[model samples]
Target: MLVLVICLIIFMTFVMEVGSIAFKLTGVEPSNARFQALSALTGTGFTTKDADIITKSKTRKKIAMILMVIGHIGLTVIVVFAVNLPQLISSWQLIIGTILCIVTYLFARNRVFVDKLDNQIESQLVKKLHFKKEPIEEVLLINDEYKVAEVRLETECSLINKSLASLHLTSKGILVLAVKGEDRVILTPKGKDIIRKGDTLTVYGKIKNIEEILCK
Candidate 1:
């Protein structure tokens, strides 16, 4: 549900960008149907070829952003798994390496085993990629689970390029644990530090409430 909502919001943002292109570049009036608006905006060489973004450089650039976002979200699962699998396996390096010859043969010869193992890897990969429920250490130290989680962000919310305080999550029961950005990961953020994009915020709070605020 959380992933679906985030993807849907991203989709809607793309659709709106398409609508803007349709109005400005294609000279076609915007419509209530976002799907149609996207088709029109992309100028996917539909029947209305004149309206297609290929003819308009600016619209084409905007379309590129949509494509890039789509590529990122769609391929994230496969790419993340491929990149992280070695790291996870390396954690058991000594034992695994000792039995590498047998394991390699077993993994390669049986289709069923290979498929099942890949599925397991994919499942674990997605679970790790989900940023909603953080680990215990990443959360604030509170006496009880009932306590509201508050993360005081020194940097901006990387995705939205805004300050931590502007996220307006304290009212929603979320706490900031750490601010991690370029060069360093600060366990506790100071007021003046600027939160930039690509920073991983370690946050804590009631799992459900925190998920609702951050994932949404």
Candidate 2:
């Protein structure tokens, strides 16, 4: 029972990690992706407006479904094992489980190990799933007042054909981090660069300011 419980815990950790990676590949931020993955796996009701990110994306929805299913089954098995734990209590089993749990925790906490494992898993997932490697428009909230977001310009938008210098985005307290054009990306785009339709702009500023200046 002890061994089964320990193995289940480790398996749950792995599933969470995989879920995080899957969310990330679908353009979710790293920290939020991990949190959402864990929340879904544990059946925790940690909903926020960000939950819409998963619901709106078909890939993310599928990933969440898988995590929830596996989480339910895994939790059920763990509960069954835990119920029998008192009856089958043995000093050796307890000691071994403790050592194994500690080892697993250490392994999970090791940055180098986790990074390598994540990289390998990410690579395989991308290859098998044909996930897009390009940058996707992801918005990240820095705090209550500020946010970083990617705004994609449309053909009919007034911003198109305008140069960054003419727009004076700096005066508006908005910083353009990068400009992803149809063919390539420009990091720290120069003021002279023209805004073309279908171009994605990564910008940072106050949440309200960003919405007013770019999202419109």
Computed on alpha carbons, the lDDT of every model, listed in order, comes to 0.47, 0.84
Locate the minimum summed-lDDT window of 10 residues in model 1: 131-140
lDDT tens digits, residue span 21-99, model 1:
3332222222322343454434343444433423344544454455545545644644554556444554455454446
Off by more than 4 A, model 2: 138-201, 204-216
Give the residue spans of candidate 1 off by over 4 A: 1-159
Name the best candidate (by TM-score): 2
Clashing pairs in 1: 43-52, 149-174, 149-175, 150-175, 150-176, 151-175, 151-176, 155-194, 155-195, 156-195
Clashes of 2: 0
The local lDDT score (0 to 100) that residue 188 gets in candidate 1 is 75
Q: After superposition, how far is residue 97 of candidate 1 from its true place, in Å?
A: 20
lDDT of 2 at 212: 76
